[model samples]
Target: MIRFENVSVTYDGAYEPAVQDIDFTVPEGELTLLVGPSGTGKSTVLGAVSGLVPHFTGGTLRGRVTVAGRDTRTHKPRELADVVGTVGQDPLSHFVTDTVEDELAYGMESLGLAPDVMRRRVEETLDLLGLNELRDRPIATLSGGQQQRVAIGSVLTPHPKVLVLDEPTSALDPAAAEEVLAVLQRLVHDLGTTVLMAEHRLERVVHYADRVVLLPSSGARPVLGTPPEVMAVSPVYPPVVDLGRLAGWSPLPLTIRDARRSAGELRERLADIAPVNGRLPHGDTSPRKDPNPRPEVPAPRRFLRRRTTRTAPDTSTPHPAAAVTALAVHRDRVEALRHVELTVTPGETVALMGRNGAGKSTLLAALVGLVEPTRGSVRVGGAVPHRAAPRDLVQRVGLVPQEPRDLLYADTVAAECAAADRDAGAAEGSCRALVSELLPGVGDDTHPRDLSEGQRLALALAVVLTARPPLLLLDEPTRGLDYAAKARLVSILRALAAEGHAIVLATHDVELAAEIAHRVVVLADGEVVADGPTADVVVASPSFAPQVTKVLAPQRWLTVSQVREALSS
Candidate 1:
């Protein structure tokens, strides 16, 4: 259904072609996954299929690209709208209407479908994507995940033969991502639709793909094969594959079930060693002690001693300098947050997690002065965030928002870093140095707009970190990052935390939360439903557990490194 023959794309001022000599064929009714490291032209390939490469993006395409037998070279995106459906990374940019129902119908209206057919398709899409509860809600009010589903539903309503998606589940929680993937599976199996998707979170979608397209670094020729065949050499891969690699499994397992079937001996080996939790460094071989450590004496003796001794100086006391009390925020009569209270001492890392529309973003915004609290108070570093001046706020708190584009405005990477250094009164190249540390391959001369989603996020984070604020706020910081990039970020955040920076991140990436966060706070319906140590919260919630934890069940393992460490020890 989709074919590319020696296709190459080069932007106007690019030093090299974004994608060079890529030849691949995606059969009808098959799901093809496009994957590579950051800035390796996954998005560029998707654009080529929809004719967006040269038609709208102003890039030069060098070979033949066809969708459903129609050459994209001769036909513009609009000309092939009936046969191809494309959804990009940014969902908000795709919406042309205010309400969910209207947004879903806008594409069909543009296609000039018969009213009866359009109506039936719209309803079917609404049911298929579980958007019935939000049919009349304003698109602006929906969370990022909801917006993503709407963006996909809008395209699916057109009943196109080929669907091209970029990072479709980046913003969704695990359950919601599964729902979206299930819909895609149905389209491929039941309706004979073709799916071509590029995603960074391979753990969620790799097992569902019928075939895999691997793009090597530096515009190298693409490789195509089955999931295990391609994943063996892919630089970025899911945790199951990582586990398979660590265990020397003959054929890598892409899903937890397969991994589990071969993990009986591995599980028995790790049963004796405790699971490592946080930023455990290399050469640190000591087994992680239990969070609630007990004395060597018997339980009754320890309980009697503790009962006699004044309950050992409550370790849970909040930092007097930075604490929130009765915080509440209301937007458009909907309570984004209500009666919430949180506190962070210096050098603490907190992860805020929940389903979409669960007030995670609202809480992060309140910390950085983006959204004002409706009632109660929020204090960070002894000052109210909403009332602080720009210069004062920069030193107290810095937020890397979900959309990194919101923080970037300069033309080139050098200029953006320079502006950040100027704004924060840092050394001349401090921001640039941090950018290099976070994203080494991105050149200073490259335009910020030309960077990949992961690179853009790294740039934005570097810009924010230049100030070295006492409190750091990040919302979904790992949306598009590969495992390697995420590891770099984890090290960076761990270093910052050690340097007395308080970090708060609101994210749907469970593996990330498992790896870095010292505390996990789960919010639901504008209220704090669960708040505790990371292990307690995530281990109890099945949807929020990491892949390794799922495979090593009833144990508190969180990452592949932890499992590897236990076996090595």
Candidate 2:
């Protein structure tokens, strides 16, 4: 369906080419996964096929990129529309229409199809993507999963032979992501549409991928092979894959279930050896909880509540938390939330999970009236969000948007945090101390923009956390952050939860969600479909649950802590 022959992409800026001497092929009717760390130009590959690299983004391109035998250089996005469908990481930024049906019909209409032809295709797509019930719903009012499906539906209507997705599941909760993946799987199997996708959450799609390709961060060449082969060689990998690498398991397990099925021998041997806790006993991880000095031989941290030592809580009524009831309202056309009921209690961390365009961000924005709901109410810490003064909201609610850069504008890291402190009516001088404590080496002299994405994320997190708000909301804090950075963010959030603060995190990254959230909430089409303690919510729905949770389902382990608990039991 597509081919890249000795393709090298050089941007207009004075830097080296993003991709150098890359040669690859996407076989017709096959599903190919492009995996890599941030800035590896996985998206750039997609852009080349969609004609976005040279046609839209300024760049000097060498070699050839052809889609369905048509060279992209000779065809623009519009010309390739009939042969290709592309979806990016951020769904909100890609929308063109205001309602669900209209949004899905956009591409068909643009192609100047007959009215009857457009109507039939629209109806088929709505049902195909499970968006029928949301057909009349406003595009902005739909959840992240709903919106992303609409985005896919819009493109699929063109009957394109190829579909290119750039982290399509990056923002979705496990369940919604599963739904989207299931739809794509069906498309590839039933309709024979070839798929070329770039994604960060590999575990979710790894099992289904026909082939996995790893892009080198050094811009040298792309590594191509089977899932296990590619993952074994890539420095950037999921924990289980890393475990498989270390265990010397021949024909390494691709899924946790695969690991579990063959883990009896390892488990029997390791059980006699003693529990491996705290951090993976023998892996690449710094001391997350303990600082100053690292431990050589680490045992997994003991679960505070051991399954064998405790009894299940009374299953009569749900525990009511002291969380906010959010009313989501955004821009003029987008009403992401409508009188939605949600809450967070003291000593609890609630994970917000859904697809890219789901109301998660809008819900986070609504919690503090950033984008106030047009009709309903939002209450934080017993008071309505709109009722609180701007300064009061700053003191009570701290938000870290998906792109941390949005929250940072100061020339220096210290100054950015100082601004946050100023909003809290606290001493500006304390910002430097707080930021330095959270992010070592951060100072008033380091330009915030010049720092790496991980550093910038940490800086933004420090700025928000300095306020020490009673209610904190974070939107995709894991984006662009390395594993260590992810661990640090998780540790700080855990500490805050222990200190009697309520936290809500919106993320598509499952392993991080598994590590942090005390409770998990699954959102679909702007409705609360599942809610409970971390284990219950994540395990209750297999399709929507994270792969880690799914693999240990019925055994019921949500995190490493729980895994330890299960072993002890």
TM-score of every model versus the real structure = 0.92, 0.76
For model 2, how does the per-residue alpha-carbon lDDT over 1-569 read when each residue is reduced to its tens digit? 89999998997752688887879898988899988876677878889989988998878889999998999888998899888888876677778988888988888888888999889998988877778878888876665556677787888887789999987776565666777788889888888899999876677788779898888877657899988888878867666665455456677778877876765554554343322234321112464322111112221132212122222222233332234444545565555555567766655678887655566777787777666567666677656676778777776778888777788988877678668778766665555655665667655777876565566777777677666676778887776564555666676665555445577888777677667675678776566666765556656665445544454434444444434443445
Task: State how far residue 43 of model 2 sits from its true place (Å).
Answer: 1.3
Give the per-residue lDDT of model 1 (tens digit) for 1-569.
99999998999987799899899999999999999887788899999889888899996899899888889888999998999998999999899999999999998899788999988998999999889989999999988888999999999999889999999999998888999999999999999999999999999999999999999886668999999999999999999899999988878899999998988888888777775444422122375444511111111222122222111212233443257789999988688999999987666678999998899999888988888989999998789989999888897889999999999999899999999999988878878877876777778888888787888998999899788777889999998887778877787776666545678999999988877787889999889999887778888888998898888887778788777766776
Q: Which candidate number maximizes TM-score?
A: 1
Candidate 2 Cα misplacement greater than 4 A, ranges: 267-347, 352-366, 370-384, 401-463, 479-485, 495-501, 507-510, 521-533, 536-546, 552-556, 559-569
State each model's C-alpha RMSD to the native: 7.6, 8.3
Report the C-alpha displacement of residue 151, candidate 2, in angstroms: 0.8
Off by over 4 Å in 1: 276-321, 441-445
